[model samples]
Target: MTEKMLQQYKVWDAPTRIFHWVNFTTVILLLLVGTLMYFKKDLGITGLEAKIAIKEIHVWIGYVFAINLSIRLLWGFIGNQYARWSNILPGKSFPAVLSSYIASIKSGEPQQFLGHNPLGRLAVTLMMLILITLAITGLVRAGTDIYYPPLGASFAAHIAAEGVDPASIKPYDKTGTNPEAYQELKAFKGPFGDIHIYVAYTLLAIILLHIIAVVRAEITEGGGLVSAMFSGRKTLAKKPEDLN
Candidate 1:
């Protein structure tokens, strides 16, 4: 048997690597805290103080997540060729490319891409959309539920009783708030809360699938798929399809 030759390619950039780990860390933290908050009662966690405290932690973590995501969004415009949206997101010719990639996979010759492969492009786009949804809904809930900033002051003012200081209003407490307006605010936030939670579950499912797909690609394709997120490089045995 002839010796196999492997090539090293600089793929992910520094900002991309940083964003990946930061996003991953913040996501895991948010999920852990969010899960606890969701099952607080069952977990024997009680009282308004505890609930607010947990939510505060979650919201803070969410702030980090949001900032990281925003930076990544901007980076997509100015980062390296592989990290740019032009390469990662599906363009006009995506369907044919996806079809070809799938056919290649079935024929036992999966195409290696320095950036994302066709299916990966789809997955990343879906994942980004989900993450953006989560960020918006989470912010809305942070404002409506615990009276956190960005939307909190406005929500508080909207629900405050006549002549009552919005600043004086407390979260989860109806005191100093107009009963009718408070009820309206609650109704308004209901759908956002629902979407936030359901989409969170969907994200979890997608993350699991993402992990599985990465592992499979690593094993069958001989690329350091997981390590690339950290080292910002990929090792491939064959020529990369998207390499320029």
Candidate 2:
């Protein structure tokens, strides 16, 4: 009987690995803080002052989330082959790859990929988009009332929606501003907030599914994916055709 030969291939680069871990931790923080803010009353905050204190923590971390996402997106363009956008975004080869992967699924020998598989690529893309939307909406809400930076300057515009009274509610900025100017900017917080929430739930669902898929893949496919994020290498059986 022939023995299997394992080959270690360098996959995720250092930047990608760091981003994975930092984003993973940051996302957990954002979710926890966000949930707390959502149920501030139940959490026994007696006053808006106490409520805003917790919100401040969430907003600060959100800044970190925004920066992390921006860098990750930029890295996608210049990072290693495995971390590049070309791999994450299904291009012309995607159709063939999808069909091929789907077919291979039934064979009980999942198709091997040094980088993200097609479905994995799709999931990554969706998550990135969701993250961007969440960041924007979160900032807009801050602008709407909390008046955090990056979006604070635009708070007036985001403060009011169509046919809504801008003065009806107090501006979070609290600096000096023209009531007329604040009133003129179109505000669509209601719609944007809904998208932020619905997409957040969707992201949560995808993340859980991602975890399950990774564990299943590692067990059944013999890929060291879980450790790859930490060590940036994958050990696979060397094909004889590649042997000299």
Whose TM-score is greatest here?
A: 1
Clashing pairs for model 2 are 142-147, 160-187, 161-187
Q: Candidate 1: minimum summed lDDT over ten consecutive residues — where?
A: 214-223
lDDT of 2 by residue, 172-239 (tens): 44334555555443355666777877877888898999898888778877659999999998887733
Q: List pairs with backbone clashes in candidate 1.
A: none
Cα distance off (Å), candidate 2, residue 186: 9.6
Indicate the TM-score of model 2.
Answer: 0.85
lDDT against the true structure, per candidate, is 0.93, 0.77
Model 2, global lDDT: 0.77
Residue-pair clash count for candidate 1: 0
* Model 1 agreement with the true structure over 1-244: per-residue lDDT tens digits: 9786899999999999999999999999998999999999999999999999999999999999999999999999999999999998898999999999999889998999999888889989999999999999999999998889789999999999999999999989999999999999999999999999999989999999999988888887768989998899899888898877
The TM-score of candidate 1 is: 0.98
The 10-residue segment with the lowest total lDDT in model 2: 235-244
